[model samples]
Target: MPNGRDLGQDRGGDGTAASMIVTTKPPPANSPGKQKTVLLVDDQAFVRQIMWKALSATHAYKVLQAADGMAAINLMRDGGIKLEHAAGTDLMEAAAGAKIDCIVSDINMEPMNGLEFVKTIRVGMASVHRGTPVIMLTAHADKHFLSTAFALDVSGFLVKPVSGTVLVEKIERAIATPVALKSASDYATLIVPDVDTPDLYASVDAENEQSKTVRATDMAEQFSQQRPRFVAISELKVGDRLSEDLLTTEGVLVVPKGTRIAPALISALKDLSEIVKLMDRVSVVNV
Candidate 1:
């Protein structure tokens, strides 16, 4: 994979090729209705063109194109898509002025992969960029890639060779979905922590004081009467009631408390154990 600097050279000096492909004409000022904007990033110009045409055909979107992850970030930071004649401006100022509804990006590109770009936007960029919905386009559907995408809070995922119609539907869905902005600490908890994980408890403790208070109150209320007994996860049996919610290391809720153990639930928990170890011990109330 070529780095951003190398791809910049490949696209004619200084990365002007990607910038030039963006529509130079600004959307009509004071137009009756504003069109939702989408940023499309792919290394291949042809792919970008196809997506641009497909999205534009809806007459519902104003499209922007980027050749790679680096170019995408630059465009996003610069505010609205740069026109051939427009004056340069800061991204924060532009983002404040105009909102971008969605981003559609390919996973593989030189200099900055889609994953890196998404991470930058989600956790490394300004608040304006952090919560924008993203739909990842990729040919690969392996668990590793999918898990990574989900961990970073990607709004949607589409396998490649998708039709323009499908693409448009995905874009709309992504736009309509609520954005759950995540912090770096949240990401770490979900992606890295496991059983024997003192790290998980530390993260929970480190959350904002208000959040800590709320969680403490909730836990206390739920476990007040029937305190849970910790047992090895492998020893769980049917008819046992969960004492608290089971969350993956990523903090995704797996099973809510009070759920009676069942074979299917056990099977699902076993699968989760392979990836997250949920927790070393199962907390259950005697039934």
Candidate 2:
């Protein structure tokens, strides 16, 4: 879900208009030690090189580079790219049959920016690329851009001058997440990187009706207010199921009203006094 209204264009980059440019996710279970490749797109050669090395070193994952949106999309849609080896091997070919596991694009570009790039892959055009998770890299992490990016279904976000540690964390979360093409995790660990944590909740039944809405602002207010207490958010398999288990010291129990909520995000609902009061106000349940 992308909110176009707040996707303000970036002012840097030596080229034209095209380019533009989350949470506690659990450490995906033992991760098969299978590191997926990531595509990094940005105009600056230095940025691309640095990011590629940093991500590769930090995650033991392969990295691809693109100068802008079109290149990134092309590399992603194309079958796959070959990295050198003693046998002159093809990593993506023998492995997953794709060059990239996910995309990390700068939101602002010359003509077709990151947002548009994501739309290109996720939209009606390509079957193989339709579900690739897209992460955003930016220097302008203003309130609007942050909220707007996620609205468009952006998987991850990082401010400019990111550290290797943070970049690895963000990339892992995105690649491990599901897209139209596939789901990222098979274990509960992927959903909540740090286990045994609690997040707060407030009622928002009115917005649940728009579960499929890709528009950013559509759920901005509610999502923003809840993030403070939302210690973590895992992707739920089903949507519109509100059933949840309140994390209390007294052995946990399930609340059956989750039909309207996404199971992955249910852990975000904590039972703090204020959170309980908020849920009560909205009549979402105080579980």
Candidate 3:
């Protein structure tokens, strides 16, 4: 501990406010390179409990949770939920406290909203947290709120009702983006949707040629690709006239019998669940 700042410094005592208790623990096993602490700020107790449960199910994170901006700021300022660093641990003295790897906050709250919270933290953060990333979790999708949030320089945005999987993916992306930017030149691994992926079919060939009664299994059995490989699928639903515009647009994924998706893909799948359901409803309607 640097200046021996106690996390429990009484707030109502003398002209100063104290922070909360340490609900979350730091990563138990530090393997040289590991993610640092994360702050979860939300007003709703139920929501916070759910978030913590999901987070705890994974890696150990030193969490300093706050119900509102004031509480959050107190924890942010007083180093951590406890007495800064635990002595000889690699954790540095609570200057700004642990390197705040990321911040997840709700948008609609009293006094200050998510946007206001972000601006405040960046403005008053200890040197370590000044550049910390913030992911705005909000229920508002209207253009007005969206515009306001973007102006605040939010690192990422997760709509309300974001699942644990999606939240984690957003966190990983925001954290990695900075490192990726440093590398400069960018490259995307293109995925040619393989029709062989079970339950997916390619109605048109790569040459935009359509075949009557195309079978998905056949398309997957034989896919031709030159580059890294991105599967091209035909958009043939039961009854709708197979439209050529599908070729002009993007493609689909042809999953194998049982393809276990990576965490990132799982996040995508969950996020697109609504779209998937809609497609399913249409699929049920025989053309």
Candidate 4:
């Protein structure tokens, strides 16, 4: 049986070995025999073009463009791009078995957003579409959005106005790393616990009614010790560690938890504050 590389080989018209013109065309630059595919989804034409051009310049990807999440989903379900001449055969089979390696999609779009699109593929789509790495592109940095994206098992998140080099780096990292899968139900449980669930306060509150007063006193002390201090954004100095993830009002992560402050980071935060005030204060661990 002919393998993927052996397909479309030059043959002899005369049906004789002597008449055969044996030649092998070189593979596309920077790729072996097959190029890894990337589905670029965005509602805007210019954004898609920019991503397409950037990936194309690397010569390591076969870029596919989609205007919306629905279109992108259809393309994924059908597998590889169908050629005009290959009729009556599955594109996946005809292509010698190639599938998309990564997906980069904009967060906001009409009909379906990026989060919805990812959920559909991960939960509702065929097994072939499941577990595929997805990188979300967005301008919003709201914590709620970040938490939702993380809960959905999105591979990576890139803030918008990203450069080509940064995009490529994110793509590479996403492809190389494997993310643990989680169901939407599991995510919901973690992000929003049931108010009626007894276990919600079990750790803090005593099970017996007799210990309620002691429990309250102990809880107050612990809370004071554990609670993070709110410091003025300007008062923040280098080397201070964040007690929790610093986020914009829109919920975008500014700096993640446990990050040691540096001069460059401080400067960036200052610049970011000019656009959006990071609440009037930031929470940091006392050093």
Q: Candidate 4's residue-wise lDDT over 75-150, tens digit each?
A: 5555444421112222222221456688888777655667667767677463335667888777643233544554
Off by over 4 Å in 2: 1-32, 78-99, 179-287
Give per-residue CA lDDT, model 3, range 193-226, as digits (tens): 2212312232223432332225434433333221
For candidate 2, which ten residues in a row score worst on lDDT?
Answer: 186-195
State how far residue 271 of model 1 sits from its true place (Å): 21
lDDT of 1 by residue, 1-287 (tens): 21111112227556443532354223455545667878787887777767766766555776666787777777666664433312232122253356778888887776777877777777656334677878777663222354456556676666666579878877777777666555765554433222122122223334466765776677567667776898877788876877876665555454556556654344334434334435566689866
Candidate number with greatest lDDT: 1
Sequence-dependent TM-score of model 2:
0.50
lDDT of 3: 0.45
Model 4: runs farther than 4 Å from truth?
1-34, 80-97, 124-127, 141-144, 184-287
Worst 10-residue lDDT window, candidate 1: 1-10
Which of 1 and 2 is ahead in TM-score? 1
25-107, model 2: which lDDT tens digit per residue? 11245645666667677766656656765654444665555667775555445544444422333233322355467778876
Candidate 1: which stretches are off by over 4 Å?
1-10, 14-20, 24-32, 84-96, 124-127, 141-143, 188-287
Q: Which prediction has more favorable TM-score, 2 or 4?
A: 4
